[model samples]
Target: MKILFNKPYKSGNELKYIADSIESGKISGDGIYTKKCHDFLENKFGYNKALLTTSCTDALEMAAILIDVKPGDEVIMPSYTFVSTANAFVLRGAKLVFADSKKDHPGIDEEAIETLITSKTKAIVPVHYAGVACDMDKIMELAKNYDLFVIEDAAQAIDSYYLGKDGLKKPLGSIGHLAAFSFHETKNIISGEGGMLVVNDEKFLKRAEIIREKGTNRSAFFRGEIDKYGWVDVGSSFLPSDIIAAYLYAQLESLEFIQDRRKSIWNRYDNAFRGVLDSKHDITLPFIPSHATNNAHMYYLVCSSIDERKKLLAYLKSNGILAVFHYLSLHESKFFNGKHEGLNLKESDRYTNCLVRLPLFVELGEQEQDFIIKHINEFYKKK
Candidate 1:
């Protein structure tokens, strides 16, 4: 049987809700279904405000505008993150200052952030890689001292929490000044190609709406808080149709089921590989810090080197299972070669070369997973 790397799962109510949204006659954004999605996210995540967007890239762009990222302003972020994280700021003419990943994990190194901050530094974008929380307390402290804004790239971090110094657990998106979440098919919860921009700072609340609504006070006008909506600030057509929200609401309603199944699949991979492969120095499993919670976004392994990873990937494919590597270090990309100062982002490059993600979707059955596990173990055994 040919196994795919990722297959989007559908909750039973998705079509029914989408049909209901169509019948409502208001298929535009911010209609009943959109309101329900916003309410669900805001209430469930304790975010001050949440606005749905066409995609996570759009949400990040909205965030860049909200923070007033000016030309020549600098934003610090990990080199291992998705292009959307950097492109958002670049679109606003902000210079990207890339940071390295931690030695043990793919998340940004919190200790190295302070060293990168300059007078031009205006914001810090920390991506919660693999739905594992970053060192937020340290990140927040650094931001506070530097008077910088924090935008959580929570594209994979749905239903994840970070334990603060006070021993209280706060949601990942809620901790940042602003956060962007993805609902792409590969993510834990999907709305095809959807995203949400979460506003934690009350100051950006009004502007967030305006930016998502194509630079208008249209949201306030709808609430009768304004006489008529018109141009207000820099914005775009960031909002998604209510039909997308309706489909997302169905997934949100079944969040528990999805989470549980995904977690089980993640654990199954972990348990299958822990003693079998982790004993060798050439391979490493994921490391979860004490302060972070896992949301089972993806399961990846780090091989000894790029050559070994390529062989392993080929092996998986030959066995009718598909495994893939993740992001290339952004600093080394062709687009940033001359722009990015020559800095040794060793960990980011290592992840780019050696990490391989296995299939871990909600619909992946146990037998199929066991077949995957068997082939992986067989490959390693021969190696």
Candidate 2:
């Protein structure tokens, strides 16, 4: 049996919605389907405003623009994240200040953020790695103290919650000043390639829409708030077509079903490996902090060494199961090494070399998962 790392699950209504969008005679950005998507996200997540973008990269770029990232401005974020996180700020000529991952989790180390802040710092980006929440309380406090903006890299954090000290649960994307979410085929909720930007601070609400529509007040014009719209600020055509939103809306309608199944699959992987791998001293399981809710975006394990990870991946591939590794540390990457201040990001490097992701999609059957689990156990036993 051949097993791929990821397979996009269809919610059964994607084509139907897409056809409806095509028949509507207006398949451009912010059409009827697009409005439905924006309403669904805002109402369900309690986000102040939600705008669908062509991709998460676009959403992040919009965020970079909203925060007014200028040359010489510093934006601190984890090194163990996708390049898009840093690239958004980099495109604005902002200096990237790389932070390390947590000792127990792949998410950013909240405790290490303050020291990275300086007079030149303009923003703090906290990535919710693998749908696990970062410590927002500490991060927010730090941002408040320093008067910095917080742009959440929540690409994998849809349907996840962060439990606060006040005993209230806040959605991950709604906590930060601005947040970006991805609907890449690999994620739990997919639209082939789509994303959304959540504007939590009202200050950026109007400007966010303008930036998304190529620096024009078109969104307002569509709402009858303006008679004419034209170039007003630096921006881009970041919004996705209504066709993309139509596909996304179908998935959103089945969000609960998708989330529940994914969580079950995640639990199966966790239970299969937990105590069973206790003897494997070099392996570390996924860790979810008490304050974070699991969205089961993906299941991953961390090997103690790069050699072990490489061997494990090869073994899985040989077994016809295509498990994969993730992310190289950005601070040491060829493009950013010269810009880095030579700080030791050991945890980031550790995750870079050791992390391996397993297959955990909604459609992965019990039999297939059992086969994968059995093979993994067999391989570790022989080690």
Candidate 3:
């Protein structure tokens, strides 16, 4: 049997909700199901406001606009993150100042961010890689000291929490001034290709809705808050269809079950590989900090070198397991390499060459998991 890297899980209510949405004759954006989704996320996470968008990229774009990113403004983020993290700001003509990832984890090094700030610096984006929370307290303090906007690229961090120095646990997206989440098929929850813009700072609350409605106050108009709506700000069509929200709401109803199953799979992989491989193998397992909770987005191993990762990926593929490597250091990419300043982001490049993600999905059976575990061990034994 071929073990795929990811298989989107269904909670059996997606079609039912879709049919209900169709029967309601409001299949456009922000219908009954859409409101349900917004309410669900807002109530569960205590977000100031939550608006569904077509994709996480659109959400990030909305954030860039909310923070008033402009030409010559510099936005600081990790070089190891997905392109959407940088593209959102780049689209607004802002200069991207890429930071390095932590030596222990793929999240951005909060300590390194302060030195990257400049007179034109506008925002600090913290990406919570693999549903693992970054050190929000330090990041937030830096943003406070520098007076920079904090936009969380929380694309993989749903249901994750960060434990603050105050001895309180706060949800990941809630800490940032603004945050974006993805419901792509690979995430814990999915809407095929959907995302949400979470407004944490009430200052951007009204504008966030206006920006989402194609630079108009249509959301307020629909709610009878305004008699007429017109173009008021620079924005785009970022809203997702109600049909997508219908599917996402179904998944939201099963969020607990999904998180539980995914975490179980993640723990199994960690337990099987932790301290079992030889020191010569030079494989580093996933490490969750003491202050973060695991939401089980994906499990990855950091091999000693790019060559080892390539061989392991080939071995997994030859054995019919579709394991894969992740992002390729955006700083070194052809598109942005010329634009990036001459900063040696060693840790970011290390993750780019070495990180390999294994198959971790809710539908993965115990037998299939064991087969994957056995093959990985056997391959390393021969190494």
For candidate 1, what is the lDDT? 0.94
Q: Candidate 2 — what's its lDDT? A: 0.93
Can you write out model 3's per-residue Cα lDDT over 205-304, one digit (the tens) per residue?
Answer: 9999999998999999989999999999888899899999999999999999999999999999988898886255778888899989999999999999
TM-score of 3: 0.99
Alpha carbon deviation, residue 60, candidate 2 (Å): 0.4
The total number of steric clashes, by the backbone 3 Å criterion, in model 2 comes to 0
**TM of each candidate vs. truth:** 0.99, 0.99, 0.99
Tell me the alpha-carbon RMSD of every candidate. 0.8, 0.8, 0.9
- Look at candidate 1 and tell me the lDDT of residue 49: 89
